[model samples]
Target: MSGLGQSGVTAVKWSAVSTLARFVLQLVAQIILARTLGPEIFGIFAIGMVVLTFATFFSGFGFSWSLLQRPTLCDEDVRFAWTWQLVVGLITMLGVYLLAPALSAYFREPRAQSVIEWLSIACLLSAAAAPSTYLLQRDLNFRAGGLIQVGSYMAGYVTVGVPMAILGWGATSLVAAWLVQAAVALVASYVVKPHAVRPLFWYADAASAVGTGRAVFLTNIVNWMLNNLDRVMIGRLLNAQALGLYNVAYNLAAMPNNLLLGALQPAFLAAGARLQGELDRLGRAYFQMLATIFVLVFPVFVFLALESNDLVHLLYGSKWSDAGSVLCILFLIMPAYVIWGLSTPVLWNTGRKYYESVLQLPILAIGALGFYFFAHQGLQAAATVAALVLVLRAVVVGTTAFRALKLSWIELLPDVGRGMILSALCAISVKAGQAAVSDYEMPLLSLAASTLTALGVLTLLLVIRPQILGVQSATMVIRFFPGMAQLLSRANPSTQRGPITNPVSEQRL
Candidate 1:
């Protein structure tokens, strides 16, 4: 009802729509690419992309966060940020190009050299578009951002990548597709919200911008390591095929976080920044975000974990069966990763920016030891270690974030304490359905039965006992569909534990 609430609703809608569209497009494209190119090719491209992705942070150096957190920005700051991005992109691109051979060699795929080299171009393209893309986020305008992402994916991956894979171009197809995606995004972003690209020639031109981004850059660097170290280890310690399988599994297990939480991130971050000084409002918003993830994302993750092998074969074909075991292991980290991700904006916006980077120091050391120990065993073992590290980091970081905001898990669990119970029930329903047809070779039928059974059980519970997810979550859900608010309330008073109330009601959003 308030201005912040209204814009946030629109932003949330657009962000969710865009991410859902992109997620669907990616799912279809990956399925096709997996069948057409197979694991070996994807593994090779993964090696290159992993490197480029890590270096990508430097290309913009978290300047986007720098933009968002700032209350005021002069033209010089924007131009400098753009110029800095372009220069760093070029440098990182060149570095990746030169190291392509070594990178490919490390992955035991000498043929990946050219692929990595070509993929380096994406760095430049994305860097060039940072100012424009981030400017939209800064303004809380996610419509153009969503449109750019979907249109780019369609133009690049769905339209280009799939065809090339079908034609047997291998990694070249992937490289080309990614470049095209970046190109399309670059062009579209600038066209929608143009920013000056002229070089400022001196860092002093935007000292405040540089100062703000320092910790964010460091934090992103460590976050990238936490996210990708397993893939790096898999590639180095195992082989291309193993890396390929793990990548696919990782993608599947992390999809919920990638799609839903990721989509909500920009909107939530911008909204939090607007109320950076309002501790109560920000903490309430944070709780709502966790609730949203628990209610919407946990079910999907549970289904994935419970039905990993069948789900893999159903979607990515039988060739990807090995990734199922790895996916099952990786599922342990999904909810934890969300906590880690959501905490970043809280830290950065609330002037606890450097605290995150510092926290990563011990966690990174622990993670490195775990990965080094388990990586040599096998993919599943490595995945197990990755999951442990993520959970640990989430606990540490999430606790720290809570304390920083003057909130605590014990205080907040009432809103989502029963989520684990709901997830457990859903998992049981899924397993029961699978067990009924365990002997049959009908993945589709089994999946359908499992899904329907789970949905039926969840719906029944929510209808009879809406308090299962607490009033806060129910209120948040209803806020997304205001018309249902009164209907649900009037339908049955006993259904909910407490009266539904907006967490952001008349607050600073």
Candidate 2:
């Protein structure tokens, strides 16, 4: 590997570990919050997040992009970015507070108004946290950033969610959990990057930062709309009960894709940042990434697609059986979504944010119209529309990457072909297991047996075709485990994490 690739890999290793830990914590938190508060409360928290999401999205004003894209940004630039985030943070909080009643009125849920206003505090805290967090990303200090994430997530889960659950707050417990995590992140930022927190009144850098960040911000907005527009539409057209079930199914369907994509996107961006001027190298890197991500994604979707009913019953309980069909259909699109995840960072890092943003408009329009026409048909209709929309979105962006990288459809098809073959194998194996155990009457045991059978089949396939596992070996991920440290150290001298020094800024994380 080149020095840039090596460093990028190490950063990714740390970031992935951190992200995995956070995902685990979040999963546990959501699981606990789900059972304790149930769908009604969980949905409330989801709506609040959606509302606050818009507020915080604008609050960044593209400051992080300025840091990530600018190779020569200085300490003064860092201070300026930090100041901009702080001011925006305060403004976001005020705006959220003022707009809370309007949001409640629109949703026609009076109880949500207070929840929205109280949760607005998190937007301010998040705003304060953004620039410090960006500095960590810019300086490749993912270990620190990861630690903050782990700490904040754990704090929210334990201190807020658990206690509130005990206190019988139900759905309100989610807001409480969010508030605690935001607070923890706010505090940790100051501790991790103290030097970047220099005081400044509103300065002359806003125009410069916003000008650079506008493209990124616009892209993010489009992505947000594409992602949540369906849910927003569902809530408006259908009742909360239907929306709640859809949310559950949608969450489960998206989980595997989100987990892999979450790890891949940041790493992709970091890798792209290092290889900024070399589109050829960037294209190759992304292709390899697409292969790796889909390798894991394929079996996951297949397993979930075949056993959506059993899995939902096992995890979220039998109350969510209505979501099974939704899960199955959404599962069909998981592989395409995973490929999109890998392709997108290349677009972002290659300064194709405007193009990416434009692509999303058509995808969003298709999704919105599809949902409108089909959503009332049934959960199946919504899921089918969603699956088709994903394929369309992936093709639009994938073709864009192909042309921009001077590649052909042939180059992309091989990886996708392999992914399809793997997914088919996995689905057939899982379905065969389901059929074999169909006579069983115990829900828990049937789920356990089906899951075990599917896993065994997947493991056997990895043994038979090692390349199908994505990594070189089944144990490759074990390198991050403390138990394998000695082995990893002996095999690769350069595998050890090293300190990075930023020449342009003295900010520490």
Candidate 3:
């Protein structure tokens, strides 16, 4: 393989490892914190986090992505990005601190004031790390990046968060955990790959970077709004407790996408940028990525939708049972969310960054209207409206992204369609299994039985027709033991009599 191809594969592997590790740690931490702190405290933290997350969109002024997407960079580019990040970080910190009172009053949660102020420290820490982190990405050194992330999460959640929660710190533990994570990441960025930190600035470099980032900045802003608007409206229209329940459901629903697709994003963006001149190759890679993502992530969402009640009860306890229906509603939108996420890198690489921001306008408007009208009804109703809006948004964005790549729905049907069909079948089987065991009183036993049945059915289907899941038997063997495939091919008498042939190799060639 070429250097870029090797680097891309390495990045993906490390990213996957990092994502899985972080997911496991966060899952444990959330379960512990939910049990200890309860929804009211989580609600308080959620309200504060909404403000903090919004300010984060501007903390780097989108320079991190600009640096990543840039074809080349010099010391001046690094310095310029660092300078802007620091400047914006300070500004955002102060802005959030000052706005804390207004945010607290808006959420009707007075505790938000202190939480926002404390969490603002994280913005500065993240800014400090941005330049180095981007440099690591630019160099395609995801191993270091992944290690930093996993270590930071461990330091934040396991070391700090769990202990603090045990000490009865309530919502403050969450904020403290975030600050520690940021600090660890900031320290690790320099330690892993030191970069010069100075006050140097060049207007031309800064302008170029800013110009490249302008659309990305707007897109991030709009995305942040689209994501958090419902939470904000819920916090305001309902109460912190309701927002807390909604936040848990939303997070659980979003976890698979965040874990799988999020891991793939950096690699995709970097690879897409490198292959920008080769449209055909880039388009093929993009489609393959979408297919791979669907195969990996779609089933998890389907399973979550089918067993939301059991999962909520088993993992989060009866206190959070109210989030079950909300989780089900959120799961309905995840496939669309995953598709939209997969297409984003394609759009970004093609210099269509503004398209996403523009497309989100209608979705945001519709979401806001829905939240306004339905939020008071309850969490499930609000989630239903949000899911409906998401489906519409997905259709529009997916069509636009496909057109930009000059790809047709038919081209993607084999990959994406198969996964959707299989996932649907898996869901139906699990549902049927659950009904067959309706007499079971234990949620845990029922959950295990349904999960096992789903897995068994899925495994049987794959064994019967591997291609339905986009995997052939030979391909699966080759993936694990590449040399064995070559050995087997050479040992075949027909191969010696004629030409050795591998359909998969021919297709790639």
Candidate 4:
């Protein structure tokens, strides 16, 4: 309806396309690597990545969001941000390199030292690209950004990761892919926003950027700690094999969140930032995003939880069967994860990041203690604890977000909750169908049949009670596409006579 709305929609579309492509490619690579290198090797790589993720967060210094959220930016601001990023990146690289031996000793995995060292290069490459990429997002130019991300991931995984895995590189393949992906992203960012590379900095600009980014930086630190605490404890308390199993399960369960909702986060933040002062519009947009994300992601997690055994068998084969149980446990947290994902952008864009960080401290402490205590029992126990903690965290964050937006759960929860109910029903029907077809000879065929039965049940339910999934609101979503409204009207003549309205606006009023 407006330029900002149109740009946001276009950005989300491209982001979805990019995320889907990358998800497929990464999934294929993951299967090949899992089959060839096995879980122990992946465990080692996962440890390195855990360390690298912390390093990458430090290197970023939250400056990207600082730049994006700034009402205005000058050349000096861009240069200062880039300079600081590079400084942080180099420091992080050296820090990881020097700490490698001690980290390896702590993890009790000797190979992790090498993996950590190799992956440090990605931090530097990311820093080099930060300014240009921030500018891209600040301008809402997600098409170019999405293309760059997809192309980099595809080229890296296909050309490097798969071949390295075939050549018995094991964890090295993942590190190689990381380096290639980061390098490509850096190059592409510079290519897209050449002016962002200019090197002129001022002290005042640097100080201003840091001041603006302090809250976000602290929030990210807390988030990283909260997210990785379970993994860290698992790697320490359990063997590489266990950690590997848990890692695979976690990733599998998180796949939908990473690929679908993750794709929309930047767009949400950018759009929210633009509408920050407009409470009514921002509230409506936030609810719509939450509802849409819930409807799309709820069934995915439910299905994954229901058929984790079959899905794991189909994807990673019988060797990873243990991961299936872990996957189910992790899936229990997906609804909370989805809510947190949707709400964080609103908090950050509305300058409530500091408050969120403060609120999260107690939750993080409790969760970390929970993980530490349960990790000794086994991976499944740890996962259960983590899931419970995540649900708590979600409740805290969701409540705070609602209060900040001056909105009530009554306005937001009905649509999203209905979708969850529908998803639960689908899961139940699928479980029943699986039992009915228990004698199916082939696992893959059984899985296919079960999935189809779930979809069929969901379709029937939607047709019978379209409001269960908020069909009116879902139909309005189609308006994001050009001429889609008219096309739908042509197909169903009753649609042509009524004007389209924003569902969240109606509900909010």
Between prediction 1 and prediction 2, which has the larger lDDT? 1
RMSD of each: 2.3, 5.8, 3.9, 3.2
| CA-lDDT, candidates in order | 0.80, 0.71, 0.79, 0.78
Q: In model 1, which residue pairs have backbone atoms overlapping below 3 Å?
A: none
The TM-scores, one per candidate, come to: 0.95, 0.87, 0.92, 0.93
lDDT value, residue 21 of candidate 4: 77
Better model by TM-score, 1 or 4?
1
Q: List model 2 lDDT by residue over 1-509, tens digit each.
A: 12135456567777877888887777676666666666666666667777887777777767766877676777777777777777877888899899998887776666777888988888778877777777777777778888898899899887778788878987677787889898899789778876566765446665666677788678778878877777776666665667777787787777667776765676667657767688766766665555545555566777778777777777777667787788888887887887777778777667677888888797888788888888878768877887887788788898788777787877555556666777777777666667776787555676667677778876777555544443212123332344543433332334446222122112111
Pairs that collide, model 3: none
| Model 1 lDDT tens row, 1-509 | 22237677779888888898888888889888888888888899899889888878888786655777777777777877887888888998999889888888878889888988898888889989888888899888898999999999999998899898888788988888999999999999999998776778466546677877787788889888988988888898888899899898888787767876757778878887887888677777777777666765676687778888878899888888888889887775698888788887788667788888788888888888888888989988999989988888888888888888888788666545567788889899998888888788798888888988889998888777665765556666666777666545633356455445553564444
- What tens digits encode model 4's per-residue C-alpha lDDT throughout 1-509? 22136567677777778888778877887888888888898899999989998888888887766788888877777777887788888999899888999998999999899999888888888977988898888887888888898889877888899899999887888899889999999999899887555555566667667876787678878888888888899999897898899998888788777876757787777777887777667766666666665675677777878888888898898889888888998986787887887788778767787877788899888988888878899988989988987887788888888888888887666777776787787788787778877887566776777788888988777555554545334554564654445433332334558534444434311
Those runs of model 3 whose alpha carbons end farther than 4 Å from true positions after fitting are 1-4, 471-509
Clashes of 4: 0
Where does candidate 2 clash, by residue pair? none
After TM-score superposition, the amount by which residue 130's alpha carbon in candidate 2 deviates from its true location, in angstroms, is 0.7
Off by more than 4 A, model 1: 1-4, 203-205, 487-499, 507-509
Error of 3 at 173 (Å): 0.7
Ranking by lDDT: 1, 3, 4, 2
Better of 2 and 4 by lDDT: 4
